[model samples]
Target: MSVPALEARGLVKQFGALLATDDVSFTIQAGARQALIGPNGAGKTTLINLLTGVVEPTEGQVLLQDHNVTALSSSQRVRLGLSRTFQINQLFPHLTPAESLGLAISERNGSGADFWRVAGTRPAIVAEIEELLTRFGLEGEMDQPTRKLPYGKQRLLEIALALATRPRVLLLDEPAAGVPEEERQDILAALSALPADVAILLIEHDMDLVFTFATRISVLVAGRLLTEGEPEEIAADERVRAVYLGEDAG
Candidate 1:
């Protein structure tokens, strides 16, 4: 069988006396849409950190495709086709989306050191930036300072920046956390349009978005793997309802 796009085996993390992650194991198959949902403090962030090398695992292994990247740095992981968005938007306040994306793409192509000098003149980088802006629906505001764009657009741009790396596996942490209801559809539409060949692991609290985007869902509680199943199966699982989903899980 082909190796999964991303895999975590026997993952564990300890901070002082607390166990942040406990024997966690999961796989994100190529092109799969997976959601990881849990209540606050469920160690969701810790798990993402472990996968991306934001912190080392106390005991476990992280694999990208078939390669063992357990000891790789965060930058190393990104170069290996693993990319992620944080719960908080990490945008350069003063730079326009075009500049940010140009820098990211240039870096990925080993021309980042001169991105500023070539941003306006490089045909290839400019083309890719324009393409990504169009893909993320930021064409109208592509040249505006990132801080001046609407919060939802800023969020979308952040995702676009991640995509600039052309990752095989994408990890999204609460992509809609602060997006207003009126603007959330834009985020949804953008996510729905992503290439099917890229595996996605979304960590979010919005159940509606979760059901609409994920074919499969994993529930986490108290730093452990609670259960995982299809969208319907998870919605009907009483254990999930009691702990995280609550009475209106569906």
Candidate 2:
């Protein structure tokens, strides 16, 4: 059998006396889509940081394709085909969506700072950017300055930028946050359209979207892995109900 695309073994993170991640272990198989869900302050963000090397782990290891990447830097991880989008939109405010995404692809190719050469001047790069824009449903908004685009569009732009990296594994942190209900379906549609070869690990609050896209779901609470299973199994879990979903009902 093939090794998982990504795996965490006994991962732990600490700041002073508080344990931000408590011995979490999980695996994301190649081509699988998994969701990470938890209540507020459950250390979801901290776990993401640990996986991407933004924060060093106090214990355990992170493996990419069964190779230890625990000590790699963030940029190094990106180069290794691991990319992520933030919970908040991160973009070049003054640049149009096309320009921003083009720059991201350029950076991934290691030429992002070639300011004298306009990204549009490169035919191959331009074509790639346009393709990604269309794929992400941003073709119509491509030329608009990122700041002028609506919140949902900006969120899409962020995902587009991350996709520019051609990641083998994508980590999405709250892709649906702040998106109004009316626009959320579009986001979900775009995500569902992503290539099946790209393994995606999503951190999202919307149970509906989570259940719709995720093949498996992992629940975290107070920095620990509460449980992980199929969506129906997680939904029916008594411990998950008492700790997380019960609050959603209230």
Candidate 3:
């Protein structure tokens, strides 16, 4: 059997008496399209934290391509081909989209300290930044500071930044959140166009995006894995309907 791109095994996290994640475990194969959905306070954020090494799990392990990475810091994990976006935008407000991508790519190449001074000197870096911005549909806005761009564009730039690291597994934490309805299609398009070799684990609440993008879905309830199945199975599940639509599970 082939190893998964990402795995969380028997994970648990506790902050004092509050158990944030309880024995949660799952895997995403290379190029898999998966979504993690749950009601509010279902421990989704905490689980992402554990997976990305933002917080340590009290118990259990995180494995990337079958290597134990539970002890790695977040940056180490990023270097090991694991990267993530955020629920809210995480971008440099004053940096243009081109500058940001250049910096991220330069950092990944270990030359960020002097990237700004000699950004135009590197043909490879310039070509990559152009490719990424063009891929994300930000070519027109490349020269504007991130804060000057629309919320949706800012979000797209953040995703592009995460991709700059060339991760094998990408965790998207609410990529569509706060995006206006009209701009959402752009986000969806960029996501659908991601490199097929990269496994994406989307954590989102937009049913439209979730159901449309994910082939497999995992539902969480109160910090535990409620169930995981194909989109059809998840949609037809009574417990899932109850959690989302306020129907009675009993």
In angstroms, give how far residue 143 of model 3 lies from its true place: 1.5
Q: Per TM-score, what order, best first? A: 1, 2, 3
Q: Estimate each model's TM-score.
A: 0.96, 0.95, 0.95
Q: What would the per-residue lDDT of candidate 3 be over residues 1-250, giving only the tens digit for each residue?
A: 7999999999999999999899998999999999999999999999999999999999999999999999999999998999999998989999899998988788788787773576757899999999998899899999998899989889898799999989999999999999999999999998999999999999998888999999999999999999999999998988889886353233
The reply for model 2, stretches above 4 Å from the true place, is 113-116
Against the unseen true structure, what C-alpha lDDT does each candidate score? 0.93, 0.92, 0.92
Question: Tens digit of lDDT per residue, candidate 2, span 55-121?
Answer: 9999999999898999999989988988999998878999998888877788888787787875678
Model 1, position 48, has a per-residue lDDT of 98
Give the TM-score (vs. native) of candidate 2.
0.95
Model 3 residue 208 CA deviation in Å: 0.8
Provide the lDDT at 12 for model 1.
Answer: 95
lDDT (10s digit) by residue, model 1, range 74-146: 9999988999998999899999999899888987887777635746578988899989999998999988999
Error of 1 at 102 (Å): 0.4
- The root-mean-square deviation over C-alpha atoms between each candidate and the true structure, in angstroms, is 1.6, 1.4, 2.0
Report the number of clashing residue pairs per model: 0, 0, 0
User: What TM-score, to 2 decimals, does candidate 3 have?
Assistant: 0.95
